[model samples]
Structures are given as C-alpha cells and as structure tokens.
Target: MNYQTFQPHPDLEALIKCYWTLEVPAEPAATKQRILPDGCIEMIFILGDDVKRYTSGEEYILQPRAMLLGQISEPFFVEPTGVVSSFAIRFYPYSFANFTTTPVKDLANRETPIRLLFEEKLAADLEHAIVNAADTQERIRIMDDFFLQRLKEEIVIDSILKSTIDTLLSAGGSATTSSLLKGEVSKRRQLERKFSKQVGLSPKQLGRIIRLQTALKILLNQPDESLTSIAYESQYYDQSHFIKDFREFTGVNPKEFYGNDELALSSLIYT
Candidate 1:
C-alpha cells in the first residue's frame, strides 16, 4: 500500500485542504475496510480497478470513477475489487459551498457523480483529462484549472459561518455555538440553516467529528497513550463520553480500533 498527500496551489489553499493519492497492489483476500468521518468533503477519481462501497451486509455499489463525496456523519465500509489507485481533492467544510449552489446537505453520506453536479459534457471532459494525465502533477493541474474556472467572480462565504468553523477547528471542536454567538442568540436558527446548506452538517455534528479526528491522530501518533489522557486532552467530559463519541463516529472503541487489520486503510488516511 502506498499513500501520499500534496499541498494545493496557493490560490486554492483556502478552499481546498490538499490533494491525495492512494495505490495498493491487489490482495487475494481483501476485506471491507471501515472509513470514519473526518469533517471534510472530497472529490475522488478512481484511476484503477473499481472499488465497492458496502451499503449493508453483502450489499455494495461500485463507486463512480469521478465523483463528489459529501460530508459523512457516520462510518461506512469499502473494499477494493482489484489494484487500487485513486486521486482525490479534500475540501474545507465551509469552502465547498463556494463552488456550487447545490445545498451541501443534499450531498451527505453519498457519492454523487460529477456529471450530476456539472454539465455532462464538461464533467466527462474533466474525467477524461484526469484519467489520461501523465502524472500526479498533471492531474493536479487539471483539477486546479477545472475548479478555478467554476469558482465565481464573487466568492460569497458567510463570515459568521467561516468564523464559527475556524473557532471549532482551532479549539479542537470544544467550542460551543452558544458561546460563539455570544449575545446574538436569535441567530442560532439562521446559523443552523446556513450550516445545513454550506457545511452539510449541523455545527455540533461537525464539531464532534472534528474532535474525534483530534483524538484519532493522537491515538495513531502516540499508540501508548492511555484513553483517559486522550479523552481529557480532546475535551471530552469523561472516558465514557469519549468512548461514546468514538463509537458514534468510528463504529469502534479505541481499543478495537488500534492495530485492527480492518482499519488499516482508515489508519493510513488519518495518519
């Protein structure tokens, strides 16, 4: 297995987190791998054999060759059908809304084909360019051009929404919306609506995912750290509360997650 990430062009740095690539040689006994939420959206292109995303036990669908995956609130499973080679763009939670008018909430937990999001011909052309690119650099250039074109002359990101997301991130998702809003409590409803459309998640939901990601990174980097210390550092109320959120997002407790073969793929990405 090989996994790598690249920084985005400076112009797109605010909207895009990074570009990533993953390649894995075929394994005769590949098993379904669980994927946890990471508080971001992604545009993925499968450059090798198809991969299967399990909808339920024994039921799965082949992911689109070029697609946009929305914010995921729960854990999901996927398995490689053969050699795996994929390139993807990870977008900031509040920034994807600048690229399209489609409410981000509509995209949650599902892979929407690029054709459905953009003109069919345009989407097809972009996919063709990516698939035929000579190298990762070429693919990155193609994506940069495509998104930069779609970017509107006036990028209207909500100031409050952006600030709220920033606070959550900087505070490791421990910041509360009420405190962020301060005296303007009436804006809570409006903020919720804005969050739904721009972020594909309620502020609380994204915060929880962000917090879990923090804990996960600690677990990956410091494998020997006790769960209690991790929970405290991550701002959870207690070990039980931390375990509850862990199970909610990852579908497993910290103990089961560490060194689990089924989570090897997820571990790689989180790391």
Candidate 2:
C-alpha cells in the first residue's frame, strides 16, 4: 500500500485542504475497512479497480468512477473489489458549497456522482483527463485546472463562518457557539442555518468531529501517549467522554483501534 497527500496550489489553498492519492496491490480476497468522519468533504476518482461502499450491514453499491463523497456524520464500511488506485481532493467544510448550487446538507452521508452535480460533458471530460494523467503531479495539475475553470466569482463565503470553523478546529472542538458569537444569540442561530447549508453539519457536530480527529491523530502519530493523556489533550470532559466520542465516530475504543487491521487503510492515510 502507498498513500500520500499533496498540498493544493497556492490559489486554491483557501478552498481545498489537500489532494491525496492511494494505491494498493490486488489481493486474492477482499478486505473491509472502516471509514470515520473527518469533518471534510472529498471528491474521489477511482482509477484502478472498482470498490463497494456498504449501504446496509450486508448490502453495498459500487462507488462511481468519479464521485463526491459528502460530509459523513457516522462511520461506515467499504471494501475494494480488487486492486485500487485513486486521487482525492479534500475540501474544507465551507468550500464545497462555493462550487455547487446543491444544498450541502442534501449530500450528506453518501456518494453523489459528478454527473449529478456538474454539466454532463464537462464532468465526463474532467474524469477522463484525471484518470489518464501520467503521474501524481499530472493528476494534481489536472484537478487544479478543473477547479480553476469551475471557480465562481458570484459565490460568496461569509467571513464569520470561516472564523467560527477555524476557532472550533484550533480549539479541537472545545469552543461553544455562544463563545464564538460573543453571546449574540441571533447570529448564533443564524450561524447554525448557514452551517447546515454550507457545511452539512451543525457547529456542535462539526466540533465533535474535529475533536475526534485531533485524538485520532495523536493516537496514530504518538505511540507514547496514553488514552487518558489524549483525552485531556483533546479537551474531553474525562477519559470516558473521550472514549465514548471516539467510539461513536470510529466504532471502536482507543486501545482496540491501535494496530487494527480494519483500520489499516485509514491509519496509513492519516499517519
């Protein structure tokens, strides 16, 4: 397996978090992997083998050759049909809406093929260009060009929303909306509505996901840290609260998650 993340072009940094890619050799049998919420939206282009995304405990649907995997509120499972290679663009919570008129909330928890969101001809052409790219750098260039062409001048993002999300991210989900709004109850309510339309999750939900992400990073990168220390560092009320939230998003406790095969792909990508 090979995984790596590429920094977005300078001009696209405000909207995109990063572009990432993965490749895995074909295996005789399939393996299931758990995917946890990471408080971001992604565009995934499957370039090698097909993959199945579980729709129910025993049911699944094939992911598109090019698709947008929306903001997820829960953990889910997916298994590769065989070998896999893909390029993905991870966008900030508030950034995807600037590219599409589709209500961001409407796309939560599922895959929406690019055809459903873009002009058919353009979407098809874009997929072809990316999948046929000669290398990772070429793939990144293909995506950068596609996004530059799709950039909109009329789509406006509110400064308050970015700052609020930034505050939550920097605080690792410890900041409250009231604190973010300085007790301005009206704007606080307004922020929730705007967040739903643009971010696909409420501020409280996004904060929790961000907190969980912080903990997961610590767990992956710092082997010396114990769960108690991670909990405190992540600003959970206590160890149990931290474990509870982690289990809710990852479907496994901290100790069980470490060195877990079900989490192999995610661990590789994140680490």
Candidate 3:
C-alpha cells in the first residue's frame, strides 16, 4: 500500500484542504475496508480498477470512476474489486459549495458522477485529461486547471457558513454552534438550513465528525496514547462519551482499531 498527500496550489489553498492519492497492489483474497467520515467532501477518480461500496452484507454498487462524495454522517464499507489506485481532491466543508449549486445535503453518504454535476461534455473532457496524464503531477495539473476555471466563476459562499465551519475545525469540534453566535434561538435554525444546503450536514453533525477525525488522527499517529487521554484531548465529556462517539463514527472501539488489518486503508490515509 502506498499513500501520499500533496498541498493545494497557493491560489486554491483556502478552498481545498489537499490532494491525495492511494495505490494498493492486487491481493489474492478480497477484504472489506471500513471508511469513516472526516467532516469534508472529496472528488475522486479511480485510475486503476473498480471498487465496490457495500450498502449491506449482500448488496453493493461500483463507485463511479470520477465522482463526488459529499459529507458522510456514518461509517461505510468498501473493498477493491481489483488493484486499488485512486486520486482525489479533499475540500474544506463549506468550500465545495462554490463549485456547484447542487444541494450538498442531497449528496450525503453516496457519490454522484461528475457528469451529473457538470455538463456531460465538460466532465468527460476533464476525466479524459486526467486519465491520459503521464503521472500524478500531470494529473494534479489537470485537476488544478479544471478547478481554476471554476474558481473564475466567482460563486458566493455564505458568510455564516464559512465562519461557523472555521470555528468547528479550529476548535476541533469542541465549540457549540450556539456559543459561536450571539443570542437568538432562531439563529441556530437558520444556520442549520444553510449548512445543510452548502455543507451537507447540520453544524452539530459536522462538528461531531470533525471531532472524531481529531481523535482518529491522534490514535493513528501516537500508538501509545491512551483512550482516556485521547478523549480528553478531543474534548469528549468522558471516556464513555468518547467511546460512544468513536463507535458511532467508526463502528468499532479504539482497542479493536489499533492493529486491525481491516483498517489498513483508514490508517494509511489518516496517518
């Protein structure tokens, strides 16, 4: 398995978190890999072979070769159907809204092909460019060129949505939405509506996912960190609360996750 991440171009730094790629050699036996939410959105291109995303034990679907995955609220399962090689763009929670008008909430937990999001011809051309590129850097140039074009359109991102996500991310999801704003009960409701349309999840839900990402990063990097210490660092109320939230997002306890073979993809990507 090989995983690497690249910084975004200077001009796109505010909207994009980073670009990433993963390559895993083909194996003799297939294994289901668990994927957890990280409080962001991604545009993925499968450059090697198809991958299967399971909806249940007995059912699954092939992920689109070039597609967008929106804010994920729960853990999901996926396995490689062949050699796994993919390149993707990770966007900050509220920034993808600048690219299209598609209600982000509608894309939750699933992917939509790029063609569906852009004109068929334009999407096809972009995919063609990436597929025909000689290497990863070339691929990045292709992707960057495409987004740079979209950037010129000058889409408006809602101010409340931007500052709210900034607070959630900066605080590692520790701050409450109410505290981020002034007195007014209805203000929270209004923010939720914009968040759903623009960021794909309520402010509270996005916060939880971001918090889990924080804890997951600690576990992945510092193997010696105790669960209790992780909980405190992530600002969970208690170990129980931390365990409950971890289980909710990852479908497993921290102990099971530490050395689990099934988490190879998760560990490699998050680490």
**Which has the greatest lDDT?**
1
Model 3 C-alpha lDDT per residue in residues 1-271, reported as the tens digit of each score: 8899998878888889999999889998978899889988999999988999999886999999999998888888998988999999999998898898787888899999999998899999999988888999998888888888888978676877788889888999988877877566678878888888888888888888889889999999998998999999999998999999989989999999977877888998888
Give the alpha-carbon lDDT of every model: 0.91, 0.90, 0.89
Q: Comparing candidate 2 with candidate 3, which one achieves the higher lDDT?
A: 2
lDDT of 1 by residue, 118-234 (tens): 888988999999999999999999988887877645587788898899999999998888887886889999999999999999989999999999999999988989999999999
Q: Which residue pairs in candidate 2 collide?
A: none
lDDT of 2 at 123: 90
As a whole number from 0 to 100, the lDDT of residue 217 in candidate 2 is: 90
Per-prediction TM-score: 0.98, 0.96, 0.96
Score residue 123 of candidate 3 by CA lDDT: 94
- Runs of candidate 1 exceeding 4 Å displacement: 152-154
Cα displacement (angstroms), candidate 1, residue 82, comes to 0.3
Misplaced by over 4 Å in model 3 are none
What's the CA RMSD for each of the models?
1.0, 1.2, 1.2
* Candidate 3's TM-score: 0.96
Better of 1 and 2 by TM-score: 1
- Global Cα lDDT for candidate 1: 0.91
| Candidate numbers sorted by TM-score from highest down | 1, 2, 3
